[model samples]
Target: MHIGKAIRMERIFNRDTERAIIVPLDHGTTVGPIAGLIDMRETLSHIAEGGANAVLMHKGLVPCGHRRSGPDIGLIVHLSASTTLSPFPNAKTLTGTVEDAIKLGADAVSVHVNIGDETERDMLRDLGRTASRAADWGMPVLAMVYARGPKIKDEYDPAVVAHCARVGMELGADVVKVPYTGDPETFARVTEGVCVPVVIAGGPKLDSVAGLLTMVRDSLAAGGRGLSIGRNIFQAARPYQLVRALRGIVHEGWSVEQALEGLEG
Candidate 1:
């Protein structure tokens, strides 16, 4: 790794645990202003106060959510976007660039690629180009890869998830995020097949906090580096406490039960 990239990675991943808990706040660009995103600063303050490793958002949102007060968290600028209203919603297009992220003072940049989509080739091209550009600046690239599209029936299939992970590593992503394979036995295969750090994506919001933390704990046991979750964390009844629980699991090595204990008032 380039010294600069390594330095930035430290900002997002805990130096002690070599893991991260990233909260993605870029959903507004895709799905519009959702519940938790309306008050960007307050939400960011909650996340920062809860000790999240970083927050990922689009270029425009940096000014909206970047903290002026409270503890600092790493910033990852998302470079790709596809609106929910789009006819081809899975086809993500580049909305920003490495240069843009650098100017925005981002610690890293991320790209999204849906492997089974009709526009898969285009997204892969974008990922390759972005990775090369990011390398020039020694900026870390996090690839959010998913097996979603016409050909995919089960996105969480361990084989499919592993393929998604491998694609990210092959394309020079410093970190890869994919849906968890539902259990440690399967998810471990996904992580073991990739050289770069693999992080689980919080797919859809879950109704149970215990369910969420259990998933996180299982993924960690499966060798995942941590997570890049959004809705489940930001939209929780108490987002800060949720993050604190996640920190317990990701950084403090707490079991699911132990982490859940911190969630109670």
Candidate 2:
């Protein structure tokens, strides 16, 4: 790895702990105009001020004029996409390259891979190629690996989830964002098998803040490296407060109840 890339990776890993608080704004690429994310600029500002360590977005969101106000949050340019208009949602194609990400001043680059989907093989190939390029450039690659396909009867199955995590590590991903398997014990096994950091994805918006906090706590207990939450935070009644509550759980190790109370106060 180049000295510069190594330093950037170190920064993303968090100086205080191995965990990270990543606010993902790349949803617009897939779902298009998600309710709370209609204004990318406002969302990015809230995330940065709320003490998130990093923010992941497409290149357009980070263009100089758009993100003018915010503390220096680590930036990870999402390099893959499958727009809502796409005929096949699972068939994600590369929209940007590591070189482009570097030119955009990205601290790292991210790609998504649907492990059990029909397009799995092609996506895995993309992951390998991207990882190789990132490695050569010394840039870290965050792989979003989710299980979905005829072969995947249950995404929450411990064995299947663990396999997904391991596949990301095997393919050279520096960090793997995966869905939590509903319990810490199962997730523990998943994290144990992977050498790289494993972070939990906050899937579709949760029913309530309490529910989201509980999931965050469970993931941390299961040895996850913090979170890569999107809708759950941004769509909340108080996005800034929600992030503070999540930060309490992830960084301070506060219990779900305590985190909620802190937010309410």
Candidate 3:
């Protein structure tokens, strides 16, 4: 990694533990202004105050999401998008450039690609090009790879999830985000042989915090990096509280029981 890249990555991945808790606010682009996102500035403050390691968002939202004073968090610009209303919502296309993210003072850039989507080829090409550009600019790339297509019966299958992670690394992602495979043993298979950091996506907001925390704990136990969770943090009854709990689990290695009882309280 370039010296500049390493320095920037440290801002997101703690220099001490090298684990990260990223709260992504890029949902507005795809899902419109949902609850907890209508006021981007307020939400950003909550996320920052919670001691999150970074915030992932679209380039346009940065001007409004930045904090004037508070704990510092790394900024990552999401470069790929597609509205939820699209016929094929999984067919993500690159909408921004790595250079644009760099100019925006971003520590990294991210792209979404679906391995089984009909447009997979196009998305892969875009990911490849984006990674190449990011490498030159010393910017980290987070490839949000998933398996969603007619052929894929179970996107959450451990085997399919593992393939998604591998594809991200093959395409040159610094970090890879995919759905959790539901159990630690299955997830261990997902992370095995993957040298780069592999973070699990929060996916849709769940009905329970314990479930989310349990998944985080199991993922860590299985050798997963940390988390790039969004809604599970931002949409909770206590947003910052949930983030603090996540921090405990991801960085401090707190057990789910301990995380909920202490930090999440």
Error of 3 at 150 (Å): 1.1
Q: Candidate 3 on 1-265: residue-level lDDT in tens? A: 7998898888889888888888899999999988988888889888888889999999899998777887878999999999999988989988899888988899999999988889999999999999998899889999999999989999999999999999999999999999999999999998995789999999888998899999988998898888999988888888888888888888887888888897535
Tell me the tens digit of each residue's lDDT in model 1 across 1-265.
7999999999999999999999999999899999999999999999999999999999999998866779999999999999999999999999999999999999999999999999999999999999999999999999999999999999999999999999999998999999999999999999999998999999888999999999999999999999999999999999999999999999998888887788986
Error of 3 at 45 (Å): 1.1
> How many times do residue backbones clash in model 2?
0
Candidate of highest lDDT: 1
lDDT against the true structure, per candidate, is 0.95, 0.86, 0.89
Error of 2 at 247 (Å): 0.9
Superposed Cα deviation of residue 120, candidate 1 (Å): 0.4
lDDT of 2 by residue, 62-165 (tens): 86325765687888999998977877887888889999999988889999998878898899999999999998888999999988887888988889889989
The residue-level lDDT of candidate 2 at 181 comes to 90
Candidate 1, TM-score vs. the true structure?
0.99
Kindly report which residue pairs in candidate 3 clash with one another. none
Cα RMSD for candidates in order:
0.6, 1.5, 1.0
Model 3: residues >4 Å from true position, as ranges? none
